[model samples]
Target: MARGPYEAAIPAKIADVDPQIDSRTQSLVEAATVEMVRFDAELGRDSAPFAALLLRSESASSSEIENLTAGARKVLLAQLGDRSSVNASLIASNVSAMQAAIGLSEDLSVENIGTMHHALLVSTDQGIAGEYRDRQVWIRGNSPHSAEFVPPHHGRVMDAMKDLVAFMRRDDIPALTQAALAHAQFETIHPFADGNGRTGRAIVSALLRAKNVTERVTIPVSSGLLTNTRLYFEALGAYREGNVAPIVELFAESAILAVDHGRLLAADIESALRDYRERLGATQESVRKILELLPREPAITAEMAADSTGVSTATAYRAVQRLEEVGILSPAGKIRGVRVWVAADIIAALDDFAARAGRRSRH
Candidate 1:
């Protein structure tokens, strides 16, 4: 019996991703670098909140990505506040498995494996969450012999994952190159019965985070991949043939593109924030005074802002009006005098992030 593509599926060596700098590639990287530097300087004060919200917006758009995001958020929020009611134990478990599977740690323990698989299975139970197949799975319509076929030992998928985790933890290589190679390897291994694609993408994010490649930032790589799924799968197929160069190049190129686009997004947000800040001016001092008062009574009248700011009721109304205009606050309802305003800027920032990310996914 011949194994054909199935036998030749896994990669044996790490992909060689040379840092060979071509003028054009260097130019693109350089531009993204400058823009990122500028963005960081301008938005450093607000990066934490911005990153937290953006992570949620991007991850929730997809089921698999959402699980990892949920896990990370759970950890992040618990450190900041009491998260007893906002539990995400299963998502956290899955994230741990991803971290282990991708070599973020020295050993992939039984507990880690159990956690990820449980998340995957339970995630499916919620709806049509991606599920694993017990038998060998095939790419539909790709195999020449048949429309679809499964390998015999599909249940041992986790065994392959153990090997993957070992490979990810191998420190003898560069992180960028390791990331690309590991992604290909994980996909080839097809460790899970289902959710492999999203899970694999999450591993890439976790590896970047672990390796300091992203430096507390998540690149929306899946949006780039989803833009051209054909090319994505083709690169995977190329890896199956023992040619890693193409896929490595593809990943690097995508990384460059994503960073460049993200830089633009950062600039847009920074500009918006700056505009809102400038518009507040002297009136902003009044608004701040009003905000200080709101905690005691979140639902207050515009007159309250005036009384707190020592301004006339008309002046207070105008200040609240400005905050509403810039998305800094929103009225509680259609009620006239006693209007409640909430911090709306955070939500707007998140919305902008999602829209830009969605556009990237469509591209």
Candidate 2:
């Protein structure tokens, strides 16, 4: 098969297209969106930190969809500013994009999408982090002629993204359905050269947040998509072929799975928190504050703990020592020259969640 010199795919404008979905799909999407809203509400006002854990879980699962795998330990290390493991660091960077998505959810503009893309890859590819591709790129093969999918030429990218952002501004569409369509359109745009998949998934997250489908936490739809990756890719292909329902149905299914899986992981993290509370029975105010911060920063130094908890470094170290004594924090060795400690139960809970959310073929 000849490779290269083929015309790029010019995706249709979706800004005003009111695509219809079947009754079954509409029902599925409605149910999933409700469950997602319920789950986020149920997590409640106090469980906000669990939001970080769930976001990291989604980031890890999303990274796996791109074949970037890393153990929980190394990822925790990377989160602590250690860059020894490149994949772990990359996966760690994904959390930033997810965060940027939710933070910028109120205004889903092309500039903010680029901001999310920048947050995703700035650490790894500063050159292309926030900028749209200036050249044509293809998927899967050495050249465009042999590629599985070819996105639009660089000349069309800005306009394509503008249309996508315009489509996102519409409130008539259902939440999950809109998110699915936006994601498919983003992938078809392939706006960036390296981090499109991650940013595309982040766009799904941003829509979910903007639509208020999930208010407190990220629902791990990426992990749900991870459960059957071939099907997910096939759904994207179907969307590009003018069949939008498949992708909508996929997001519906993915949302249901995300909520189910997220509930289980939340239970695990909450259980660990209970145990930590039990171990520390009666503790100082600073110690109490540090315990609350553990799930978000399982691996940390006294400095980070102090900064996050608004306690003195000495007080934070004392609290860390107490937690270390009670087995809540164990030595994580060192990042650079500073000693770090980890909350073993929290990391174990995270690892367990990651293991359960790992790849599985759908029947």
TM-scores, one per candidate: 0.58, 0.97
Return model 1's CA RMSD, one decimal. 9.7
Once model 2 is optimally superposed onto the true structure by TM-score, how far is the C-alpha of residue 111 displaced, in angstroms?
A: 1.3
Q: Which 10-residue window of candidate 2 scores lowest in summed lDDT?
A: 354-363
Model 1: how far is 24 from its true place, Å? Answer: 12
Q: Once superposed on the true structure, which residue ranges of model 2 sit more than 4 Å away at CA? A: 1-4
**lDDT per model vs. reference:** 0.52, 0.90
Candidate 1, residues 1-363, lDDT tens digits: the string is: 334654323334333333333455445444534443444354455465345433443343233233233333233222223234234433333433343434432233334533444444453344423434455655455652353323335655556655666666666655555667778877776655566665666666666656555554556555445445556778887776667666666666666555554565556556655665676655557666664443223234676567666988987887787777766666654333344554444434444544554453443
